[model samples]
Target: MLRFKELVLTMQEFFYFALRAFATLPKAKRYWRDVLDQAFICGVESIPIVLVSSISIGALMSMEVGNLLEEFGAKTMLGRSTSNAVLRELGPLLMGLMLSARYGARNGAELGAMQISEQIDALRAFGTDPIAKLVMPRLLAALIMFVPLIALSDFAGLQTGALVAQYYHKLDPGIFWNSIYPRLLPMDFVVSFLKAPVFAIIITLVSSFNGFSARGGTAGVGRSTIKGIVASSGLVLVANFYVSKLVFDIMH
Candidate 1:
């Protein structure tokens, strides 16, 4: 009950801050440079890691699913299974987890450090709304970047699966490619990218909340960073289930 209460209160605070951030968008144009900088950091700098992780996931899926299907003389289904898994599950989930660990912790620590060092207070002294200047850019960047990143991850996973099927599984690339499209529907693509925004929201809100709530000093920043990652990742996984369920229902 205590934890649930804390969760509710934190969510309330998040929504409040989010609304203020959104309302301040007219002034956001002045911070366009900051938003772009954040987008580069969160999206561009993240590509290599996302690509590598996605490729590994794809390769693993091909290997495991190929072996399972081969036992039943159904090796041709490898591409279908791997593609579906990547599109429906691994793509968004892995990207969210990666971003939560990388960006979430960094965002929290940066803000927490600012808070502890009185920089946030100084911003207020200058009549700047920290939510607008600080949180809004990060929020906007996360919202904008997650969809493309997930798409890239999905593409990487599918490519790797195809490669693994051709070289490792001794399956024909044409067979793999042909099976992928027939097994996929437009809704699968929609659902894949849809999960990303929710995960992005989780990361932004949880990280910023922890950052804003940081107390003590440098040590507090460290703690907030860890807490932010944990909370954001947990929420991403929980939200994934519900979002996936809703998508499933819609598709049906």
Candidate 2:
């Protein structure tokens, strides 16, 4: 009962806090440039990793499917299984996990450090909307970064899957590509990418908020870091299910 009540309270706080955050966006309009800059840092620079991971994952996933299907003489199904996994799950999840580890940790530490040093307070003293200037950019950056990175990850992962099928799976390269060809479309890519921005916004906002509102000195930073990663990852997984269902339903 206590846990359930706490869950309810958390949900209430989340919705309420989100509402309040939305209302404050107008006040942060002047800081769009800052947000873009942060987006580039948190989102763009993370691209190479996302890309490599995505492609490698693709190849690896294909290999897994190849192994399973080899017994059934259904090696051609490797493409579909691998593609579906990437499009439906791994792509967004991997990207989200990566961001949670990289961006989430950094956001928490940066904000926590600022809070402890009283720099956040100092910003308020200067009549700046710290939430607007600091939090909002991070939020916007997240929104912008998530989708592109996910797309990058998915594409890379698929190619990796193909490579695995080609090499370890002992499948012909041409046949593997041909089988994979029918499984993907431009629209599938779009749908895969679409999930990323949402994941980005959720993580970015949550981590920044967690960091900014954190207390307890040195321990608080560590706690916030863990919380941010957990929250970001949990939300990403949960959100992916709903997003995938909606996208597939619409597409079909």
Candidate 3:
């Protein structure tokens, strides 16, 4: 019961925290430079990790699924199958998890450090809305950047999968792409692209909240950062499933 109450209180605080962050969206113009910096941190800096994960997953899926399909003489379906998996599901999902770790951890650790060092308090003492100056910019950056990251993830994954299909499975490039482009649907793109902002929200808010709640000095920063990454990554996975389900249900 005590734990439950603490959980409820934490939830309440987080609700207000996220509310304040979103409510400060208009203040973005005031913090445009910070927003640009955060964009670089979360977006541009995130590309390498995102591409590595997506390409690895795409190759693995193509090779493994291609082998399995070959058993049933269904190698021609490789493009369609791999395309669906990469574009609709794995692409966005991997990007979210990677960003949840990379971007989320950065937000948590940076803000947690600021919190512990009393920098945030100093801002508040000076009559500055810390959420508006700090968290809002990160939130805005993530929301704006995640979409393109997802697009890049999809593109890199599909291209890597195509290469794997050609060399590893001895499939023709033209055949593979032809099978993919024709079968591609708007829903596939919808499911892939829509996840960008959803993941952006979950990652940015969760991390920033934990950061603001940091305590216990340096150790607290570490704990808060870990908590942020774990929580955001888990939430990303959950949101991925629900978003896919919700979209497919509505569209199909």
TM-score winner:
3
- Cα lDDT computed for each candidate against the true fold: 0.90, 0.78, 0.95
Model 1 alpha-carbon drift over 4 Å, by segment: 1-8
Best by lDDT: 3
Regarding lDDT, does 1 or 2 come out ahead? 1
Instruction: Show model 2 residue runs off by greater than 4 Å.
Output: 1-13, 24-29, 185-187
- What is the TM-score ranking, best to worst? 3, 1, 2
TM-score of 3: 0.99
Determine which window of 10 residues in candidate 3 has minimal summed lDDT. 175-184
What lDDT does candidate 2 reach at residue 213?
A: 65
Each prediction's TM-score against the native? 0.95, 0.87, 0.99
Candidate 3: regions farther than 4 A off: none
Clashing pairs in 3: none
For model 1, residues 1-252, the per-residue Cα lDDT tens digits are 999999899789878877886787677688999899999989999998899889999999999999999999999888888988999999889999999998998899999999999999999999999998988898889999999999999999999999989999899999999888877898788889889879987898789889999998888999999999998999989888888899889888
Tell me the lDDT of model 2 at 104. Answer: 84
Worst 10 residues of 2 by lDDT: 14-23
Enumerate residue pairs that collide in model 2: 54-156, 54-157, 55-156, 55-157, 58-157, 58-160, 58-161, 59-160, 59-161
